[model samples]
Target: MFNLDQAISAWRRQLAAGGIKTPEVLDELESHLRDDVEQQVRSGTSEEQAFNSATQQIGQTNVLKVEFNKVGLAKWWQLPIKLKGMLIRILGREQPFPFPDLNTFTPRGLQTLELAREEAPRLGHDFIGTEHVLLGLMKSEDGIVLKVLRKAGVDNSAIKAEIERFVGVGPVHEANMAIPYTPRARKALHLAAREANALNHVHISTGHIFLGLLLENEGVAGHVLRNLGVQTETTREAILKDLAGS
Candidate 1:
C-alpha cells in the first residue's frame, strides 16, 4: 500500500536531482499530475493507482529534465531575477558601474537601444530619449517589462496607436545620420543606470530602463506612459513582485 503523497514527494525529489531546477516548472508538472490523479479517482481508481498512473503519464524524469534544459540556453533566460546578480559575478570577479561595460546589459536592454533608434524615425522624433526607449521596451518579447505591460492591458500596438493619436505625424528623419538623445532622454538613461546600481544590480535590464523613464517624470516618455494608464509606482511595484516570484 504505497502512499500517494509519499509517491508524489519522491517524484519531486527525483525531478530535482535530474536538474529540473525551476520550481515553477515542477509546480506546473505537479498541477498536471494532480489533475490526472483527480480524474482517475473520480472513475473509482485507488489513490495509489491514480498517483502511479499520473507519474508515468508525466513521463520519465530524465526526459522531462532534458526538455527543461533548453530554456536555459541563454544565461539570462534561466533565472531572470538573478540576471544582474549572476553576470556581475563573472570570472569570479565583479565591477561597479564606470568600471562596468556594455557586456553588463541584458539582451532586452540592447534591444531597447535598437528599438529606440528605429522608433524615433517612425514616430518622427529626431532623437532617441526616454519616450523612444520606453516604446522600444514594449517591442521586446523577452523583457519582464512586456509581461508587466501586457498584464496592465497594454501592448506595443496599443501604445503606438495611442502615441499616434497624441503626437500626430511630423517630418520623418533621414536615415543617413543619427539623431541624438534629447537632454531629458539622456538624463533618463543616466537615471536608469543609477537605478540599476542602486539595487546593486550588475546589469541594466528592461525593468530598470522602464524605471528610469518613470524617474524622468518630466520627459515625453513619462507623459506618454502616464496617458497609457501605466502609473510609475504601480508598474514598478508589479515588476518587483514579478522578479521576486521568479
Candidate 2:
C-alpha cells in the first residue's frame, strides 16, 4: 500500500539533504507531489501504482536537489524585507506600495533598467544601482512604469532629463557591465548593486531596490500604488517588521 504522507516525508528528507531549507519552498514541493499522486490515482491506478508512478514522474530527487541548490542557494529572500522596512519608514502605516510583480521586472518590461545603468555616470553617482534604476525609470519617456506613474499625475520628465544631462557632463566608461537582463526577466538584479551601495548593507539585497523604488521622488511608487487602490505602505511595513523580528 502506498502511504501518501510517507512519500511526502521522503521527498522532504531528500530536499533537505540537498540543502533546501525554506519552509515555503518545501511546502510548495510537497503540494506538487500530492498533486501528482492524486492525478495518478484518478487515472484508474491502484494506490501503490499511483504512488510508484508519481515518484517516477517526479524524476530524480538528486537532480532536483542540485537544481534547487543552484537557484535558491543564497539569501534570495532578504532584499525585499529591507525594501519594505524603508518604505514603512517613509510612507507610514496607511499608504501602500506594490512591489513590481515578476512580470513587470522583465527586461522588456523594464527597459528603463538599462537606461538607468547607463545614465548613472551622467548623474555623477559613483555607482549604478536600484536607486539609479528608479531614477532611470522616472527619466524614461517610454517606460511602462512611467506611464503608470503618469496616470497618478506624477511628471517624472523633469528629473529624468536632469539625470540625463548630468551624465552628459560626467566621466564615462567604455565597458558594459550591466547585468545581462532581458526586458522580460523581472529579476531586478540590475538594481542589486545599487541597493547594496545605498543601504551600506554587507551584501547586494532586494530590499535596497525596494527602498529605492519607495524613496525616490517623494514615494513615487507609493503614490502610483495609491492611485491603483492598493494599500501597500502598512501591509509592507508589517511584512518588514516580521522579517526583522525573524
Candidate 3:
C-alpha cells in the first residue's frame, strides 16, 4: 500500500532543498530509485522495505550536496531581484542600466567569458560572478581590458593575491560542469550590449564589457575595481578615450 510516486515526489522536494535541483541529476536519481525498488520487491521485500532500501542507497542529503557542489548548481536564485536592482543603482550612484540583449561579443570579448569560466573554479566559487569576469579580463594578459586596467593601477598579481586571501577554499568545480552566472554578471552582460548600442557601435567589444562591469556596480567585481581606484565614470571616460583613438 506504499505510495511510491508520492514518496518519490516528497524525496525530490527534500533533495531540492539540499541543492540537488538540477533536473538531469534528479531524474536520473529517480530512475535508479525505481529500478532499485523493483529489484528489491521481486526479491520478496515489501513495498515499504523496497522504498526504504532505495532511499538509503540513493544517499543522504548532505552527501549529495557535497557530491553535486562541483556542478555549481547551488542556491543563488534566492536573491531578491527588486532589492538587488535598487542596491545596484545606489552603489553606482546612478540609475540601474536597462536590460539589453547583448548578443554580439567580439572574438576576444567571447574569449573573456571562457576565461571567466576557468577562473571561477580556481577561486573555489560555485557561481560565475562579475568578480570572475574581472579576473578573466585581468588574466587575458594583453587584451585591451587588461591594458586599461593595468594603466589605471589595477595590478593583476596584486588583485588576484588579495582577493584569494579574502575568500576561503570552497566547492571544487567539476570538469564540464555547467556554471550559472550570478545575477549581477548577467546584468553586466546585458549592460555591455547597452553600452555598445549607446555608442552606436556595431559590435559588443571587451571595452564595452568593462563599461558593463562599471555600470553594474553593486557586484563584487565592481567593489574590487573600486578598491583599485577604478571608478565608473573614470573607467567609462578611459574606454571612450580608447574608442575615440581607435
Estimate the TM-score of every prediction.
0.54, 0.31, 0.59
For candidate 3, list the clashing residue pairs, or say none.
Answer: none
Strongest candidate by lDDT:
3
Q: Where does candidate 2 stray beyond 4 Å? A: 72-246
Q: What tens-digit string does per-residue lDDT give for candidate 3 at 67-160? A: 5453222332223322222223223333244434435777777777888888877765646678778877777643676777778887888677
lDDT of 2: 0.46
Candidate 3 has its poorest 10 consecutive residues by lDDT at 77-86
**Regions more than 4 Å wrong, model 1:** 1-103, 244-246
Give the clashing pairs for model 1. Answer: none
Candidate 2 C-alpha lDDT tens digits along 128-186: 44435656555555433444345445456654544343323334544255322221112
lDDT, candidate 2, at 12: 86
Question: How good is model 1 by TM-score?
Answer: 0.54
lDDT of 1 by residue, 96-194 (tens): 223224577788788877788888777655445466787788877565888888888888887777666654545575542445554555667777788
Q: Candidate 2, residue 205: CA error in Å?
A: 30
What ordering of candidates by TM-score runs from best to worst? 3, 1, 2
